[model samples]
Structures are given as C-alpha cells and as structure tokens.
Target: MLDALRIEIVEVSNEKVVARCPFMMQPDNTLDSFMGSFNSETVASVGSWNLLDMENEYAIGLEISANHIRGESEGTVKATGFPIHKTTMVWEIQITDENDKPICFSRCTTAVNKRIKKNNS
Candidate 1:
C-alpha cells in the first residue's frame, strides 16, 4: 500500500518518525486528497517504524482516529509522528504535517507483540 501511495520514510528515532507522500491526482484530474485511511496508515507506519528501531517486536495498529482539517491538491505532504504516551504494550502517536499544520491529527494505539520464532525441530 505504501508503494502504491508512494509513501517515503524521511526519518525515525525513539522519539519520533517522519514520512512523506506525494500528491497525485486521479485519472479524472481530481485531487486524491489524503484520506482518512492514508492518514491512519501514516500514523501506524511511523509508530511501527519507531517500534522496529526499539525492539524485535511486531507493532500492530489496534486503533486510530483522525481529524482532517483541510485538503491539499498539490505539493508533497509530510507526516511527523510523536510519541505522546506509551505503555509496555501500547503506544500513542500524534501526527502533524510538514509546516506544523494540522492536516490530519491522529492518535494511533499500537500493540507491541513479541516476535515468535518457529523451531525447525
């Protein structure tokens, strides 16, 4: 899905993660403004990316809520995720745009599950 949307990871750290998605119009020339699903995915991706840098656990999105303030028809948009709060098993991420604009504010809760290894025996 990320590939289809051309989402690119800009940066990642224990504190935050950043990503970019280019604006592309549909065949009808109508702007495919970043939708709720895309916003949700961005949040999840950032959170998961951060988790991957931290441990060998699988980060799965349990829940996400987004509030899109406005839509853009051109230029690339960037999403930055901040670790607002977190528990051992769950994390809360806040997303903002490149200009610090509230494009789609979201809170994502991710479940950090330990990776299980299969025994070849």
Candidate 2:
C-alpha cells in the first residue's frame, strides 16, 4: 500500500522513523491538494512495533488522530514519528512539505500482540 502511494521509508530506528511522499506521485483531493489520508497512512506506517525490542510481538493501531494543518500541492512531504510512551505504545507524527513547513500532525496508539502461530492440522 505504501508503494501504491509512493511513500518511502527514509529512516528507521528505535527512537524515530521517517517517511517521504512526493506530491507528483500522490493522489490529490478535489482541490488538487494533499489528501489527509496520506498523512494518516504516513503516520500509521511507522508502526509501534518498530520501536520495540521484543521479538514475536507486533503492534496494531488502536487509535489515530490526525490534524491537517495546511495543504501542499507540490514537492515532497516528510513524516517523522517518535515514541510518546513506549510502554503504552503511543507515538506522535509530524508531516512537513519540501520547504519544511508544517503540513500535518498526528498521534497513534497501538496494541501489542504476540504473533500467533498457525497449526497446520
């Protein structure tokens, strides 16, 4: 899905993750501006699992809140995610345009779950 949207993971680490989406490749709204869903997707793509050291466990988004502060019609937009509360699996994301101007802000909460193995019975 990220490929379809042309979203690329530029960086990743235990403390932060960054992604980029270029306007030329993104789907636009009626006004030919960036879609808020792009911000949501960018925010969600960071996934809380990436920040955790636990193996065999993955995180699924429980809630997401995005604020589309401004619109951009051209250039690449960057989304950066950082842990808000590691234990609770909360994160904050900030999206900015090529000029480094604020485009969106978001917060996400996820639930960590053990990856269940399937029994081929």
Candidate 3:
C-alpha cells in the first residue's frame, strides 16, 4: 500500500518524466477514531514536489530519440511513502523535438487525498 503513495520517475525510450510532491507518514491516527472525533474531516497536502521524508526537489530530463517516431508513453508506478493510501501532486513535462523545438508539453494535477495526523492533533 505504501508503494503507491510515493513519487517516482519513469523513463521510456529517450524520455523521462518525474512526479513528486512534499508529504510523509501513514495514518498516525486511525480513521475509525478520526471519523468519530473531528467536527470536519481534515485533509491536505502541503508543499510542491510532495516527496516522502526527503525534501521536494523534483525534476525530469529526456533525450529525443534518433528518429523521433514514438506517439504515446506511460508506465506502471511503484513507490513508497507515508499517508499510505493517497498522495496529492502536480506534474509537468516538456517534450522537445529536433532543433530544440517543443513538440509536446503537458501539465497534470493528481490529487490523491491521503489522510495525515499532525502532532498537534
């Protein structure tokens, strides 16, 4: 379960994409207890590049293929982090073509809502 909540980078052929944010820890408090206690559900992800214990310093660089003949790209994600179930993040990648031209560029926001229990709680 922890594996799904972490940030990662995937390389396909000559392109690499990095996804990350700033967050750490699984439920310090149980949901059963949490649901039964608070007036409102407290859910949030603070910081860009929501990486685990490590600080959020995320980046991705890719090399264009020799012939540039690919269409779509994707990869299965296997990562580890805290708040186990949900991890919120935003990812952006710019694909440059020959002559340093931007062939494709994309930005996506994945809001995985992983619950966390702060010490103040």
**TM-score rank order:** 2, 1, 3
lDDT of 3 at 38: 13
Q: Write the per-residue lDDT of candidate 2 for residues 55-119, one digit (tens) a residue.
A: 66777777877777666677887888888787667878888887878877888777777877787
CA-lDDT, candidates in order: 0.61, 0.69, 0.26
Which candidate should be chosen as best, given TM-score against the real structure? 2
Which regions in candidate 1 have their CA more than 4 angstroms from the true location? 24-36, 52-56, 88-98, 117-121
Query: Which predicted model would earn the best lDDT?
Result: 2
Model 1, residue 21: C-alpha shift (Å): 0.8
- Name the lDDT value of residue 56 in candidate 2: 68
Clash list (residue pairs), candidate 2: none
- What's model 1's lDDT at 105? 67
Model 1's number of clashes is 0
Task: Residues 43-120, candidate 3: write the lDDT tens digits.
Answer: 112222234343323322221112212222222211111232223344333333223343233333334433454578
What is the alpha-carbon RMSD of candidate 2 to the true structure?
A: 3.7
Q: Count the backbone clashes (under 3 Å) in each candidate.
A: 0, 0, 10
Clashing pairs in 3: 3-79, 21-49, 21-50, 21-51, 22-49, 22-50, 22-51, 25-82, 25-83, 26-83
Clash count (model 3, backbone only)? 10
Cα error, residue 59 of model 2, in Å, equals 0.8
